[model samples]
Structures are given as C-alpha cells and as structure tokens.
Target: MAESEEELKNLLMKVKEESAKYGLKRNIKKTKIMATGPITSWQIEGDEMEAVRDFTFLGSMITADGDSSHEIKRRLLLGRRAMTCLDSILRSRDVTLPTKVCIVKAMAFPVVMYGSESWTIKKADRRRIYAFELWCWRRLLRIPWTARRSNASILKEISPECSLEGQIVKLRLQYFGHLMRREDSLEKTLMLGKMEGTRRRGRQRTRWLDSVFWVTSMSLTKLREVVEDRGAWRALVHGVTKSRTRLTTIFTIFKEDMSHILSIYLSANAFQHSVVPVQLVTHKQGFRVTLIEQEHEWGGTSACMEEHGLGIWDAHQNAYAVHRNTAWRDRSLTSWMCSCMPTPLVPPASAMCTEDWCGSP
Candidate 1:
C-alpha cells in the first residue's frame, strides 16, 4: 500500500528472515521492485533460476519449476513460506488490502498432482505452467500506511508468546491445504465426468469429491467481520442463493448428517489442552450422531470457571437427572444435539437451534 522504499525494504527483510528460519535462502539478485508504474511488483530469487514475483505487489505466484531436483522443491517451499508471512502481516491490519500473485509460467513438480499420473510413462519436462497461486487480495486493497499502523497496534493486542511464525505455519497446513483440496477435487471431478466421451480416455482417473463444508482459516474475529458486514455478507448470501440449486443436493446430504449428530461436549484448560465429544448418542434407540464444531474456540464464557459441558437428549444420558438441569437450553435441539440435557422439548427458531457455542452455567 505504501510506496516508500524503506517500508518495502523492512517488509522484505522480515520475509527473508522467515525464509531462513525455514531453512530456505532468498536470492536478492533475482529480486526486483517496481515502486511506481502501471503495475507494482516484488520479485525474489528461487532455486535453479526460479524466481517468485508478486504482480503489482498484490500477490506472489511461484515461477521456475522445470528442474525436478531437491533444490527446486526447496525453493517452492520458500515460496510457500513467503506467502505465509505475507498472510500474517496482512491479517494484522484492520483494513485488508486485496492482493493477487500470478505465477507467470514455470516447470511444475509432479508432487502437486500426486498419484494422478500414470507410472507407465516418463514424466514430461519444461512445461510452462504456474506451480501454485497465492492470493493476498485483502492486503492489496488496504491503504498501506493505515495497514502498517493497524498491524503495529494489533501486535500489542496479541500475546508476545504467540509466535507469528507458528501461526503462519499452522494456517498454511490447516486452511490453505483445505482450500486446495476442495479446488482440486472439484476440478478433477469435472474432468473425470467429461473424459467418458473425450479423446484422452486413458488420462481419466479417480479423484476425491469435494466436502460439504470447508472451514475458513481466517480468525473468528475476521470471520465475524466478514459475515456480519452488510456489504460482504449480502454479497456472500446473494452468491450462495444463486448457486443454491447446485448446493441443494449438498444441503440435503448435510441435513442427513445433522440429524445423526445427537450430543456435544467441550472442555479446555489453562494450557488450552481441549477435548470435544465428537459423537453424541440420541434418545432414540439405534440413533447416534457426531458433533462438529465449526467454531475454533469452543470454551465456555465464564472467566472464573474455565470448565464447560454440553449434552443433548440421548439414550445414555437422557435418563440421568443431572442432564436435565442446565442454564441454557436450545429447544431446536429436540431433533439433534444441544447444550443442555433433557428439557421441555419444543422446536425453536432455526437460528436459535444450537449448533456450537460456549457459555456459563
């Protein structure tokens, strides 16, 4: 956002430090910066003549992957490391700036499309393609100086013990992998269906189907901001509605799963060691459902008593009187799992139907 050379240098230095921590080195000679122009850019060196370029400083996409050597893999890993750093820095800002990194063209590692290629044939070499794509759209859209200031302020709000590097690594493994998995599954499924009548019948192969829900890696606060913001929320709802027909079948599948999940229990300690009862038995005979909390933090609201409990009316616990007494009750949970134990059963409003939350006794 800010075009200052010093600011850019400092940010790049931070990225370089992160790369070295990951046992990867950055080659600055391949690095280039376009401070002012039709398009701003940041380029960093890669292994075997590979280089990563952030198009217009909006995003960094991987390039130069023709070599199948270990060195090339190391460079790709560095590219990912750089991306993780950028994401953390961007999230620290209150106002997100959108960024897009386009990998110009390069050799792709066979590992990306693992298990799909036939072992009978020799691997192709030197194809011009983007190995990976990284989008930092939120960071690009923000005002630079404001973004930096907000980031600085956010550091004070967070714990010094909470390592940003650790966070980046976790986010990369958790969310980015999920996103890629979903995208790859969808692409493969479409391609597989079309291969029946296509010329490349031999290339047809099995791929996993996309799951119904993929958790957003963004923090709860960020998620709440996006989902609650009128503009962003409206757009999301509208888009979902437009795709409702395609998702209808998926929704039915989800409802089936929801009906099967009967109980929920969550607990956490000072060290954040947590336990969540995944599956809860229902009151009905032979019916048991699993509970999946979309929310990351499932601790109760009480600051003094950190321990919390939740249960649905199930065959095992329903007969117990202790399950019947609880401060909060979700009437809609009559059909599924709930926070309270057995209660005066009634169908509550759809929104009121408890899914997952934490609160005091």
Candidate 2:
C-alpha cells in the first residue's frame, strides 16, 4: 500500500480510473480493509471501507496473525455438529458398530477436516483434534465416560490410521503428490516458491509442510526430488498411513446382539468365528464330524471328531449328540448313517441293511 496521503490518493484514483473503463465501481460499503501495523485513515472518493480484525473466506477463518488455531476450533465445532446430526444412527441399537464408523468416516470426518491439507497444526491444535476424535469414538461406541478402557483397546477395535490426524496427514501428503505432478501451475509455483518479504520481529511462522517430515522423512528439497517417483511416494504414504498403533486384533464384528445367534463361537487369537453349516463327512473309520470347536475364541481350525450319537437338540436348524462310550473305531455302520437322523429312524443294531449309500448320493 502507499504510505503517504498523496500517494494513497493517486493510487486509489488510478484504481477508480481503471474500473471506470469497464463501467465497474468498488462497493465501498461492502469492502473491508485490514492491516497488520498501526491503523491508518484512508478515503476513496469520500467513501471509507470498514476495517476488520478477521474475516472468513470459503470455510476457513482468516486471522490477521495467520494462525490456524481459529480454523481448527471452527472445524471442531462444525465436525461435532455433523456428528450430532447423525446422533440417531450413531446411537441406534439397530445400527452395527461398523456401519456407525463408516458413517463417521464417510460423512462427518470429511466435514470436520475440510481444508486440513493447508493446516499448520500446532501442539495445542493437535491436542484439541485428538481429544475431539477420541470423544467421537467414545460417543459412537457408546462407551461410558466412567469406563477405564485404554486408548489402545479402543484403537484396536477401530484403527488409529483412520483417525482425523491420520486423515489429515494422508490428505496433505496426497495434495503434495498432486502438486508434484502438475505442470507449470500457479499452485505448484507457490508451493515450491520461497517467500520474499520483510521478516516479522520473531521466529518464522510454521509452514504447512513442516509437519510432513514425519511422513516423508525428508526436507522440502529432498521431498521435491523423491516425490517425482510416484511409486516410491505412494509406497511411502501407504507405509505411513498404515496403523502403527493397532491393537492385536481388528474384528469385523464382535459379540453383538447375540439374540439371533445360536451355537456361535469366537477365537480372540484367530480373529474369526464359525459360520453356519458345519460339515458332516462320512469316513471309513465309522464317521467323522467336522465343526468349529466352541472353545477358545482363538480356535484356529475346524475340529474333527469320531461319529458321536445325538445328545440333546432342538427340532429346528440342528440336532446334536455324542456317543459317550463308543470309540470311533468301534462304532457300527448303523450309527454312521443315523448320526444326523433321529434314533427311531436309525433303529437298533445289526438288523439294518447297507444299501450302497454312496450310490444313492
């Protein structure tokens, strides 16, 4: 801006004169002026524009100090509102945990972290973001505030790689990569260009890329060189985006609403469970039953056992029994065929005829 009153008047006149050629006029009432140094009085054709300490552009808060703290706070507020908008689904007994998580990731998270790629996050901003993310998880999971569940445990259920911070890192890195690939664009030039200006009286403000060292493990100079190799840059991002803090298991689903589930088993170690239709295979050694064991949650494989007589069962879905005294080797043919059927159909011992069961099947 022009420092002297005469220069300011001439500069403002020139601006007005240029606009007159296009028949355009500045909206002085709508225009606003902001300055970092001492406030000054200026006039444009007897109209004065209002000065403001801060203003909003797009969704971001533009502060005179160029701090992103206000933007982060606003993001949190908007993000929280987005979560609250889905409160019904989030807290619904009918919605599964996975679905709720998807809702948050697909909808709420993006809204909250919008424009995060340009953020120069401070320690306080990091803390606020993390706390808000944790709160979202706790709320979605319906975990009580009084609960002492370790963050590790909660993070085990839902990966930390999927958190807000992780998302920002990914988005920023991806943006960097996109900028790297572009040709002769203003965005690319600005990103690569060094600022040339009078220095402020204190330490230099943090550049958005300053935090990216953790992901790239390289300074801006090296980043420019390395990012040219798209494959390597992608690999770096994949490696960084992978959850380093995951718990031992990532379950697709847990013991959820077991009212509709019967005869289910889980192995914590295996991170899998038995599904429907346990197999019944007939072996020469009498018969062998194949089904997942209902023991350790970590039960790794299907269990095989000798043909056991039916014990107790319900009429629907399945019937189960075990031959307590009969060794699999000692079991008779009649027991093998009758294992799945009722005792009445199986009948007593040696009277039954063996009619080529394999031929029938």
Leading candidate by lDDT: 2
Off by over 4 Å in 2: 1-26, 40-42, 195-203, 243-361
Candidate 1, 1-361: lDDT as tens digits: 3457467667877888899998987765665554334433443333122223232221223223212233333434554555555554445555322222221111122222222121111112111111222111223333343454432233233212222222222332333233333546653354235434546557632222211121132553454456445575444333322221100000001223455433232211012222354433233333333332112132333332233333322322221111222333555334443334333333223312233333312
Superposed by TM-score, candidate 1 places the C-alpha of residue 155 at a distance from the truth, in angstroms, of: 26
- Lowest lDDT 10-residue stretch of candidate 2: 265-274
Q: What TM-score, to 2 decimals, does candidate 2 have?
A: 0.59
Q: Would you estimate the TM-scores of all the predictions?
A: 0.20, 0.59
Q: Mind giving the per-residue lDDT tens digits that candidate 2 earns over 255-359?
A: 234333233321121112222333233333333323332221222122221221122121221123232233223434244432243332222233122431211
* Highest-scoring model, TM-score: 2
* lDDT, each prediction: 0.32, 0.59
Candidate 1 has its poorest 10 consecutive residues by lDDT at: 244-253
Q: Which stretches of candidate 1 lie over 4 Å from their true place?
A: 1-54, 58-273, 276-280, 283-286, 290-308, 311-361
